[model samples]
Every structure is written in C-alpha cells, then in structure tokens.
Target: MDKLLSLCMIVRNEEKVLARCLDSVQGFVDEIIVVDTGSTDGTKEIAGRYTDHVYDFTWINDFAVAKNEAVRRATSKWILVLDADEYLDPSEKNDLRSFLTGLDAGQPLGISVPIYNCVESVTSGKFIESSAIRLFSNLPTVYFDRPIHEQVVYRDGELPLRSYPLSIFHTGYLDTVRKEKEKSSRNLNIFKDLKGLEEYDYFTLGNEHAILKDYKKALYYYERALTKKTESMTIFPYCRYQIVLVLIEMKRYKEALQYIEDNLKRWPQYPDYYSMKASVYVNLGFEEEAIELYTTALTKADAPAGKDKRFWLITPSLGSHIPLMNLAKLHQKAHDFQKTVYYLSKLVTMNVNDHLVLFQLLNILVPNESVASVLNFLGKIFDFGRADHLVKLLHVSLLLGNKELCEHFHQACVKQNIEMLAQQQLLYALVFNEPDRFERHLPEAGSGSSTGPLNKLIFLAAIVWKREDFSSYLSPSQDESDPSLELLQSMFATLFHPEEVGVDLPFDVNYISTLLIDLFKMGYYDSYDWLIQQYPQYYFILANILGDYFYQNNHLQLAVDYYSLLLDQKQLSGPGYYHLALLYLYQGETAEGLQFLRSAIELCSHESHWYIRYLKHSPATEEKKEIARQYRDRFYPYVQINVVEQLLKGQA
Candidate 1:
C-alpha cells in the first residue's frame, strides 16, 4: 500500500462531472494530480477539494501536454489517468490497488482499462466499451503522446501491455455533455488543422467525422488510415471496421459486404464481423445468407476478443445477443414462432434485464399459451420473487395483452408490499377489464395517447361503451416508424377529427376492425361505421366480423340491413351472399331469400345447400334445368349435388 496508484486527470470546464469522477476513485488512489487548462468554471474548485495538487497550465490545444503535466506531479509508482467526465465504476474501485500490485512485475508498462462510453442517456444502459491505456508505470520513460485520443508511449520503442478489468464509465460523449461542450466540432477542427498525421490520427479523424454524421468524410479518413504505411497498427482492424460502418450508414451495402468479407478473412475470430456481414446481406436482401452467416457467427463468439491486442474493440453482445436478436427478428418476420422463441429465449437467458427482448418473447408466447404456462415458461428466465423482475414482467404482460398474467404479476407486487405505481394500477385495471379500477387510476394515467398500451385498452373500453366520454382520451398518434409504438393511431381519427384523411393505420388495423363490431353490439354503430368508411379498404374485415356478430346475436334484421349494404356496395363475397340469404330466410322474406340464394349459388356454385334451396324455390323451367345440369357436371357429383338435382326432378 506504499502509494501504488496516483489519479491523474486533465480537465477544462468539467465542473458538472469533475466531483463525481474524483469521488469514484478517490478511495482507491494515494494522491490526486489534476492539471487544469483554462477552465472558466468551478472545475478547479471541485478538483482542489479532492487534491492540493491542482495546477493550472496555459491552454495549448494539446491533450498530451496537459495529461503529461498531471502525470509529472504524481508521487505514486503507477499512474491511473482519467478525464473529468469519466469515473471509476464504484463496484470495481476496490479491485484497482490489488490489480495494480498483482500485475506481473516488469512485464507490462501500460495497462489498458475498459471504458464505457455512454452514448445516450446513462439510465438507458446504452453504451459502447473500449480499452484505453489509462494505467501505466510512473517512470520518466513512460509518458503521454499524441494531441487527441492520446496514447501512453514508452520512450524506448513498443511498450509491453496488459488489460485490467477496471470499469470506467465515460459520460463525455453523452448528447447533453457534447452539446454543452461542442466538443465534436472542437475535436474535428483540431484533427482538420493537422498535417502529416499518423495512422492513429486518421483513425481518430474518421471517428470525429462519424460523430458529425459526415459518412463520406469518415469513410475517406478511415480508408486513408488503412492505406497508410503503418501496417501493424493496433487500430488497423478498427479502421477497416469503421469503413464498413460508414459504408453501411451511407447505404452502400454492396461495397460494405466486399470490405467486411475481406475483414472476416483477416479477423475471422471476431463475431462482430460476421454480424456486420449479416447486416449487409440483410440490406442486400440475401436473407437466407444473412441467417446462415449469423448462425456461423455464434460458433466464433467465444473466440478470445477484447483481451487480444489485434482486435481490442470487441462488443460483448455481438457474438451472442446481437446475432440471436437478429435471428429472432428474422424468424419472427417469417412467422416461425418456434425458431423465434428459440433465439429470443437464448437472449433472455443471457440478459434478464433486456426488457425489449422480454417484450418480444412474451408477444410470441402470451397470445398462444395459457397464463399459467407462460408464467412457468418465463419463470425459468425470471425470478418472480424479485420486485424489479416482477415489474418488468407486469409491464411486458400488459403490452402483450395477457390479462391474467398482468394480474398475477400485479398481485405479486402487492404481496411484496411494493409501492404500486399509478401506471401499474391503470394497467392492472385495463388488462383485467375492470372499469371501476381503471377510473380510480385515471388521474395518474400519464399517457392516454392513442398509441400507448394504456390508451389502446382505454380506447377499447371507451369505444366498447364509446357512447360515453371517449373523445377526451383520443389523440393523433404519430407513428414515425418506431415499431413498438406504431399503432393504428387513426382508427378513431374520424370520430375525433372527421376532416383529416390519408393517415393510414398500419399495425393495429385488426384491433380497430374487431373493436367496430363490439361497438355495434353496444349500439355504438355510427362511430365504427365512420371508421370503416374513412378507411374503406378494411370494409371486408368489418363486413366479415360485423356479419358474424349480427348472426351470433340472433339479430336477423340488423344482419339483413348490414349484409344488404354489402350487397348494394358490391363488397359481399359468395359466402357473404349466402349468409345474407340465410338472414332473409330467417326473417321469412321468401322472395328476397330466393333472389340472394340464386345469387349465392351463382358465385358459390359448389354449395349444395344453396342448390337444394334454389331448386326447392324455383320452377323446373329449361333455364333452371340448364343451371342444375351445369352445376352437377362441374361439381363432379358430390352426393348432395346429385341428390338435390334428382329429388327436384322427381318432384317436378
């Protein structure tokens, strides 16, 4: 414990994250050395609180200079470098000192630590991991090099390296942080001004371009990195990898496929290359090849990665979750439930906290199986006893419309004495079809928009009794291509905004079609009819479901009225004609029944019942006899067909 590690950081205007950074590793380090380069904010004050070694240097637009200055002040044997926006993961704090001392002495001068770059919201669990030489020997021979994306270089040629399991979370790349600093522009401008740059500079410039969404420039720089004289550069594979990504983002899939195919030959051990190749094949519409490649990728997923110097940029999920998730999605699109479940269940087993995958899995299983069976199947993947697991289960269950499962999870929450969220109560009531419970939680229903699961059920319940206050809950759902939220937002658009047209409902067309029939049962026919007329393309769905509902309810007159509309509109099929004829017959309208029965038989000529009824009704004129003779021969003589014709002849 003789001052084994010193925390060295270079900061400028990082007051927001400086304290959080220093606080995370302060316990692990012997002393803190901070070099401030023109921070006009409270960055220095916060750094001073953690260490007296806070020294200010003139701004030189070079990261290496500031970082070297911080390293110069360290009294410890080992230097642990960090940025103001980066913090040592608290869970990994205790492992630092033991890991430093435990390192095989005199072998590795530079120790790379795993850094997680939080790309979006920190709470979202979305991040990319990379290794950086943050830990190094504090000897004078080992100092920092490069201006941006700086690296630790030993004075006497190539430095022996080792990777440590030091988890550091970097928030500098977060959108809020990026916008505050305008750091992308700063980095890009710095890279742009430099000439006669190295392979690392070109690679770093490519990343900067990619950040700015200038894919062409990114591709240009990445290619330049590959073409440079540095053949054995550690970042060479990454340069090629980034080139493929830039090509992909530009939708140049064919070009990407060739480069990635080449990359696979060189770095065949990395599963991400296969995954990327599969993604390219997907874009090129080679679905089977994509599937085959993804499966092949699984075989190589366990290949030594990140730990290897040749391919340090290993995405852990690429080998397992990425390929499995892709395969699940592919099989799901093909409607192969068995394979979809097989792949998704694998993903769920790996990451139980993956709620998106859990939702997709439940979506497949919940609709076809019983609640008990689904819960049992999911129980293998989840511990229902845990409150967080129970909450996720309850959420996904609601999304899948598994009422009993939602109830089961909700009740489990109750057992845990967990504070039931208003949203949870709303979902519980909605799923269980309890109007009273739903009303109790109405005020707390944060989102009742037409797209939300809560609103879908609320809208269904409202339109079920839609004669009541349904309009207040309806809003125009903007389905800008995010699949989970893409719903038939405009299903009730007619009722709410009658004049709005041409906003087609893609995902929830069936939901609204069935809802229309339910509304008709509750005497809410006008609104549903308006919905159908607005998107008249779904009239066949409305006709089929509404006709069945009318028949099932013993409402013969309403059935006749609805069917007559279909017949009048020429939307009625042969079965629809026969169905209408039956309704007329039930109503004792023999003449109308005869006309529709003949019309039914004319279109659905194979129905012997229609032939038998038609023959019984009409006279045996030559024209009628001709119809009978034709149907009998054309139908290849079902016993009913011959018997109906012969019996009619005998009666004549």
Candidate 2:
C-alpha cells in the first residue's frame, strides 16, 4: 500500500508512556519511524511492538538532531512528529485524517495542532493548551532547529501554517514526570552551551530560567530577546508578556506597568497584556482600576487566529478564567458581596471542583441571605463527597435553626469520614434550647470524665444551658471588698488545666462568635467572660462582636476597649473607627477622639456624618474645625462645606 502518513518519534527511556502513545494512534498512521537515541530501558522493545523500523542513533544533547533523524527516515507524503509523552487524542483522529485527505503535496505546509500540557499529576491536575506544528508535508526542506527547545522550520520556502481541530495531550511536563526526568536542568545546560544566539534562543533561555524560578536571569534574557525581535516575529508579544511576569515576580510593579502599557499600545487587541495590567493594578491596591481592566480583558479574550503562535500555546479558549477569578476575589476584598457572589457563581458553573470559590460564595451567602435561599442554590451544585461542601451544608442547616437538617448532615458527615470540631459545636448548639436534649448531648457537669478539653467544651455548653441568670456575678453595685474568690477560682480552675482542653478544638471565628452570642442570649455573661478571659489569644473574634454589641447598647467605655483591641489587630471594620472615636469623645479624650474621626472619614467618606456628630458635640478650636472642613471637601465633595462651617462657628 502507498504510504499516506508517517508517524515519526525519537525515544530514550520512554517505555513508561510509549505504549499509550502508540495505542492512541493505532490505526491512524501508515508507517511508524522510531529513532532510538541509546535507550537503557525497554523503550526499543516497546517501539518494536508498534513498528519494525526502529533505528539506533547516538545520544547527543541536541533534541532537534534526534527529531530530524526520525523525520529523515520517513517515507510518506506527510509526517506526524511528536514526543513519546504526547499522543493524538483518539476523538480527533478521524477529523485529522479527513483534514489530511483534503490536502496535497503542492508546497511545504504545517498544521498547528492544539497541545494540552498537563501539570502536577494528570488525573487530578489542570492542563495548559498550546499549539505546535507537529504535522507537516514530508519535504526535505522542513527540519527542526535549536538544540533544547526545538521548532520545525521550512528552510526552502515559506511554510504557510494553519490551525486545525486536531489535539494532542502531552504529559511529560507533569510535575511527577519532570521531577524524575530533571528536564529543565538538561535543557538549561544545552542552552548555555549554544553559541551565536538568535532571538528565540534568548527567549528559550528565559523560559528555562522561568521554570527554575530564577526570575532575575529570566528577566535579563527576556529583555534581550525583545531587543532582537523582528517586526514579524510571532514570539514578540509572548516575550513582552513574560517580561511583565518576571517584573511582577521581582516586585518591580513600576517597571511591569510601563512595559505592559507600551505593549498594550503596540498590541491593543491582545487580552494577555490587559490581563497582566489588571494584576499590576491589584498589586498596587487600585482595585477599581483592576476591576475595570479585568473586565476589559474579558471582552478581548476571544483572540483572533494567525495573530501569534505563542498565543495558542496557552488555553486562550478559557483564558478568561484567570481574570474572572481575580475579579471575584477583588470584589470580595472590596466587600462588594453581590458582585463576589455573581462572579463566583459564574466560576462554579465552569468548574464545580473550584471548592474555594464555592466556599467563599457560601460563606458570604449564609450570613447575608436567608437559609432557604442558600439551600436552594446548594441543591444544584452540592457534592457530598467533598468534605468542604459538607461543612457548608452543616453550617447552613444550623443557621436556619433546622435541628432535623443538622442531625441529618451530622450523620452524613460521620459516614463520609468528615469530623470537625466546628461540626460538634454546631450539633451541641442545635439542642441547647431543650433542657433534656441539651443534657443528653452535653458532658455530665462536674464529672471527672469530662475533664478533657473536648468534654470541657461540652461542660461549657452545659453551663450555658444550665445557668440562665448571671446578674448576681455581674453587678455595678457589687462590693469590691467582697472578693467571692470561690466562684471565680472554680471557673478559673476548670479553664486553666491545659491537658483538659482537646488538642483539636476548631476555633473558627464564625463558630466562636456563634458560641459567644448564644451565651450572651442566655444571660450567661460570666461564662462568656470566662471564655474571653481564658482564651485572650482568640479575643479578636469576641472583640469584633462585642465592639458592635457595646456600641449599640450605649456602653461607650466597653465599646472603646473592644474596638481598640480590634484596631490593634488590624481587624477593625468601617464603623469601628467612628464608634471608637465617639467613645473616646465621651471619655473627654478630645485629641485621640478626633484622630479616629479622621481615620473614619478616610476609610468611609459616606459615613462622615458619624464624625460630624462628634464635631457638633465637642468644643473645637478653629484648627480642628479647619481639619474637619478639609476632610469633608476632599472625601465627601458633594456635602456643603457651609454646613460644617456654620457648625464650627457654633451658630447652628
């Protein structure tokens, strides 16, 4: 039979993947040409199973040389060259053959096949799609170049390259395989030995350095590559993109911005440049600008064909995923929870395995919206096998006050081997309202078996349920001299024992806050105080809740203390500053009070009225009034300065 297609490959110690590659293209090609470059394994024997024409070649450092030798031995109209780690997708085989049947041996031409490069472990990891000219006419002029990262170039004529739907899966770049092969070190050594470097040689060297995370060297070579880049060089945009990445990695945001801006001007339609600019904006805290740029990048993400080969090297089809996730997180950071949920929902539709996005969406939704609303959405996307999703279901059920749902999920969690301290706490809280049920779940009070941390936590739960009145332990009129040290000391003794506390107490902020709020509701103020006093390290959770609690209850001094603790921990909310300042003013600390007022204005300008109230109360000098007037004009420009002016004049 007249040969139509020749499958050409160079092998060395590729026995592990050789059979899989050959099996994928079993009946697709006419002849197989395997060029063995000194294999020390069963690679040649495996090659013998697929083809009878396995030839021996001396091992050299140059991959191009070995690859060219395989092509040289092919005797067909067309050649399909690939690495042993790569295989033609079986689904794409028929399409590939149909496309090939339409072409003739008129001129040297190449078909750019999409390559999916898997990383980490193949079964559980992600892939990056790239395009490579692995299929071409069997012309003597078409050959590979460079020593390490080779490319097929038609030296005799202009090889008109076109993309096809055919795809290949390459797994040699997987972390597990790369670790065993040490391919980067081998490529780097070969790259270093090459003399009279071309533009691409520099780029390849930069890529090698990038793989090793030597950003400084990568940056230098990428810059050098750009200098030598020709007007028609397809790699120019990729080099620009990589230079920006290297700059960003080096924390040189200023330089990265300049380079990206210049590239965007030169290649305004390229989404990759805009995507990078958005990242730079995020790094610099220009979140709104980042959101704008990311949105702009999404609009331009559908990259046009024949623009650049490097563009096809990455999965341009779903390149928007990166910007989408970035926008979701940026909105999350800005506390635009609606937009956060919107983007995260979109991401979940694309990949349900994005558990982090699911977790983030659930976290915001359960607190902001009703339980029914969250449950309705979770029904569509929930996967019980995912422990994190079970955790979400457990929390949502508890939040809805659905004891039956909580118990159902509790059994599901245990069955699924999902054991968490938060789960136990939630279960304990579900039955705390019923005396009999509460005691049923709670550890025996004062029982020696309940001395361990887990049981001690249960004992605490019992106290919250058993004691409804704490007024006697906490009263303003209590005699300071009446040191009823007995009750206090007994409480301290239970808490102070280190061994009694379980090693695996899940001190999540939400769960801890929930526990504290339950105690406050049941009038167990002393018990709440005991927990906070004993675990002062976890007081940020309590402080956040208590700050608002005290402020709303008109307990100014208590509000001030908790808010100050939160501020010291960098966990203060937008209203925390204003509340703290108001408390300070109530205590006659005018200087500190005004300082926090300014902070409040800077943080949330729309809430400047909070600061204005204190200015309306405090007797301020002209200097203080001028400071307030400036802040109002700067942050809240729509507000009338005359109103503040009149208040400062003490006439209003």
Candidate 3:
C-alpha cells in the first residue's frame, strides 16, 4: 500500500547538519523526497543513504517554486515540507505519527503545525515557539503561489483544515553558520526583478532587503508595499513592524515612535508591539514611558485576578525578564544606588543567577556602607574559583575602606593563584593607608615575575606618599651617577608626570598619571613638585594632572590654564586633546570643547577599544548638548539613552 505521510525537503550545501534532521524523522514518516539544486557538497551522496526518491531540479530564483516542485513529487496522501536545518523531537515525532494515522482515516485539506525558534548558548537555551502551516493535502484543490511567503490557495468552496498540536523544531532561523546576508542578497535581486508581481510579493521583497541590512532600500520597498492597499489590515502591522525596526536601526526614533503608536492603536494585543514601543522610548531618552509600557506588558503576561480589567492582552512564552532587565539597567545607569539595589533584589527573586546581577550592581552602587553589604552578599552566592569576580569584589571592598573584607577577599584571591589580584591587593593596601600591609606585600614581587620591580616601585611610591615617608625613599635616589638612581628619578617623573614618558608606552602614560593623582590626593604634593622640576619633559603631564585636580577642587580658571599648556606641548596628540576638551568644558568654552571632542572622536573611531569610553567621558554643556546628542545617535545608536535619563532622574 502507498505511504500515509511523506517528508519533502529542498536543500543545497546542507551536508553538515542534514543527516541529523533526516535521522530525527526517519521512524515517523513513510516516504522521503529529497530535492537538490546543484549542491557541490556531499549532500546528494548523503541523501542517497536515507531515500531512493532523490531528484534534481534546475535552480530557480523563487523559493516557492522550488518548494512546490518538491511537494509535487511526494507520493503519499499528506505532505510535510521542512528545511535541512530543521528537526523533529522524539515526542513531537510521535505526536506527528499519531496525527498522520488519524489523517489517513479522515484527512483534511491542510493542517497548521507549530514551529519553535530556539536561541541556544545564551544565558540558557530555551525554546520560543510559534505556529505556522507546514502540512497539507496533495489534492488538486490546494495550490501555492508567489516566489516568497507562498500562501495556501484554496478552491472557492469551503476548505477543510485543522490546527495540529505537533511541533517542528525549526533551526533554519537560528542556524548562524549559514550566510544569511548572501541568501538575502540573492533573494533581493530576484525580488527587484519581480517588483510589480503583487502587493504580497513587494512585502516579501522588503523583508528580504531588511534581512540583508539594507534599511534604506527596505524602507523604500515597505512604503511602496503599503501604497498597494490591496493587503489586509492585519497584514499591514507586520510590514509596519519591519519598517519600525529599520527606522530604529537608522536612529530615526521619532518616526519609529509614530509607527509604533499607529500599530498599538490598531493591535494592542501584540506583546512584541509593546516591546518595540518600549525600545523606541528608550532611544528617545524617555525612560518613564518605557517603564510604564514594560510594566503594562508584564501585567498582560499574567492572567487578570482583581477588578483591574483594563490590562492589555499578552501572549504565552514571552518572558517578562527581558523588559525587567532593561529597567534595572536604566536605574543602574542613572546612579540611583537604592533603586538599582531594589531592581537587583527583584531580579534575584525571579530565580535569575544572583552572581551576574550582583556583579553589575556592585559596579553601579556608590562605595559606602552598602558596598560591604553587597560584598558579603556576593560571597554567600558565588564561589571564589572565578578570579575576575573575586578581584573586582576586592577592589570594591578596598575602595569602601572595609579592610577586613579586603583582607578576606585577598586571601581568597591568593588561594586562586590570580596574578592580577596580588597587584590589586598592593594598591588596596596603599589606598587604605596601611604601610605595614604594603611593606609585607612589597617583597613578594620578583625580577622575572609578572609582578616585577617596576610595579613594585610604583606601589612603593604610592605607599610612601600615603605614609609621608617619601623623604626616606628618595634620599639616596637623588644621585645621578648610579644606574638605580636614574631608574628612580625616571620612575618618580613618570609616576607624577606621565607626559614625560613619551610614545614608548602611550597606554601606560594614563596609568602613571592616575597613580600620581592618587598620591597627590593622599597629600604628597612636595614629592610631586620635586619630580615635576627634575623631569621638565613631564611638565605637560603635571600641568594636565593639576588641571584636573583644580577643576575637581573648583579652581576652574587655573585648571583651564594648565590644560592649555598641556595642549600647547609639541607633538601632543591623544591625551592632549582629551585633557584640553575637558578643560574647555570647565572654562565654559562650549564650542571649543566640542571642536576638541569631535577631534577625539575622529581620532579614536578606528580604535578597537576605548572609543566608547572616550565619547562618554567628554563633558556636555547646554550649548553643546545637541552636538553630544548627534554624535551619540550616530555612533552608539544601539545604546538606550533613556536608561541614562531615568537613572539621572532617579538619582535626583
């Protein structure tokens, strides 16, 4: 007898994962029809191992044509079409087999099967499922049309169809190995050729362009598709969603907001619509509105209990944590210590991994009584085997003047054999004004070790500055004849005036300057001034550091002059421009500050790292706020600035 169910597939170069898919459905389906369109890989050879009904067809520009051809070759009563990257779970296969047996007894014209799109290897792999029609009768009553998004065309009479509970594990969208852009590019060319085919065809073309990351072209096509007016109102929202996504990508948040408002007015039941709306508010620096929408979305997820009957409807499998995380991030950015802690506590209650959330919380929370509380909280949750987290925790503890906590974390780090932890521990000792602890750790550094003499000398300088013992350390080091004396002199100059170090260690220049500031803040100005005079080359560094110190201390004009001198130095570049821009902001020269800001932005645009930091730390004034906004909107468009706004407001 003929088979009751047939598995139809069209593939090219899918040899890597095709066997796994075929093996998944082997026991459930009775017939397998594999169609190949010029695959040079061993895909055809592999397909022969599974079935005898393998056939080749000429490559066509239309996917629907290829799929329809594959479906026509099925010799069974029912056809189930799937991609090579898709598979059937064992339980789902059993469900399908049972459904196939029932269909054989009384088969419908078509059936809709559920498809699950799963994102794996993120925080955790979980399936997000949706439904689509993939199974249908092979009778002449049902046919497919269009090159893409082919719909089931029924005869003018009442057609029989059923929604099956069986699900297909769809990996096609999640499979990142396949070059999606190449596929989209190929489809886009075909779409352009068939521009006037139909309104639905134009929408498909727009989707194809959107997938290819050609937002401008995608927007043009989607607008043209909307003009057709032949498509249903329900279909209009999907096109609008795509258009809004493109607008967001282009940093056209205002236009995107309008599209979202129109979409929500028509279909507020769509959960994704609310999520997109929240995203727009985030882009436009409107955090309160975004949070309101997110809270509404969360309420919709849960079934209504009390008299609040006006909540929006939400779909299943859409988790509330996605928006909650965004909200927490907003609070953190605004430096609202209490609210940041509150959100983090809520996140932990939701069964989130507390370690991750707590680490982020520590980064945002101001160092104080809460710092000790957070450190203790972290110790209770995660193991110290992770050196990075332990080191970070140690840094926070030291900053908060929690010596006991710092010592405890330092012991944990020592047990973990973390090299960087030792350096951090030394710095911590200096910061806390503990000379005995610093002396004890000083001898631990050796010549060949990663923690070497140079780092040790820097640490000692900081410790001496803290303890007012610089005279003892620098007494013998003033003699110019000894090699160690020159080393000491250069170290003193570099530590206090890093601009003297020149181009050999460009990155290290900032490191030295930061150490000098710490020493100065600890009241070691006498040694700082001596080093500045001895190493005249470091005059620029001293000037810049003093400029920043004065600015922070509210001596704005003096800071401006020092920064100007640093900028005027010959061959000055990176640090020079950055410091000058900051000084201009302090002096209320907003236009000059922006000019320097733009110069810094251009200089660092090609740098792989630190570019974001460079842009973020540059001061913004009311006169230059528009310039700052434009730069942020252009370069870092993905960041949600309303998050920053919400944070600032919460802090206020």
Q: Candidate 2's residue-wise lDDT over 1-652, tens digit each?
A: 1587899998889999999999988767989999998999999999999899899999789899998999988898889987899887677677677788789755789888777877544542256666678898888898888777788898976778987767788999775687678888988888778888888888878887887889999998988887644446766766777788888898677678778788878877656777787876665435566788888777776555354533322345224667788988766544456888888887776666555555566656654667567667776777766787787666555444455556667778999887645324534453445555544444333233322333334434545554423222321213333223343334434454546655543344544555565565444678777666766666666687777766654345677788877787788876788767755666678788777877776777665445455565556566466656664565443233333445545422
Report clashes for each candidate as comma-separated counts. 0, 5, 1
Candidate 2 lDDT for residue 511: 41
Cα RMSD of all models vs. native, in order, equals: 15.1, 13.2, 13.2
Error of 3 at 637 (Å): 16
lDDT of 1 by residue, 1-652 (tens): 3688899988899899998888888678899998889989999999889989999899777888889998888888888888888887777767777777776534438988778887756654556677788888888888988777788898989998877878888898886778789898999766765677977888888888898889999988888788656567667766777788898899766577678778778877778788898886665434666799898788777555545533324565567767898998777644467999999898888877777788777766765778778878988888988999888888777655565776788789889987667666765664565678777776666554434545555566664444346445544445433223324444444445646655554435556655565445334456566556755667765776677556544455676677778777887767667766655665678678777877887787766546655555556676467656765676433324222335545432
Q: Which tens-of-lDDT digit does each residue in 517-571 have in candidate 3?
A: 5555444567556544644555566566667655544345666666666566543
Clashes of 2: 5
Ranking by TM-score: 1, 2, 3
lDDT of 3: 0.61
Worst 10 residues of 3 by lDDT: 310-319
In angstroms, how far off is 465's CA in candidate 3?
28
- What RMSD does model 2 have? 13.2
TM-score quality measure for candidate 2? 0.60
User: Candidate 3 — which pairs collide?
Assistant: 334-647
By TM-score, the best candidate is: 1
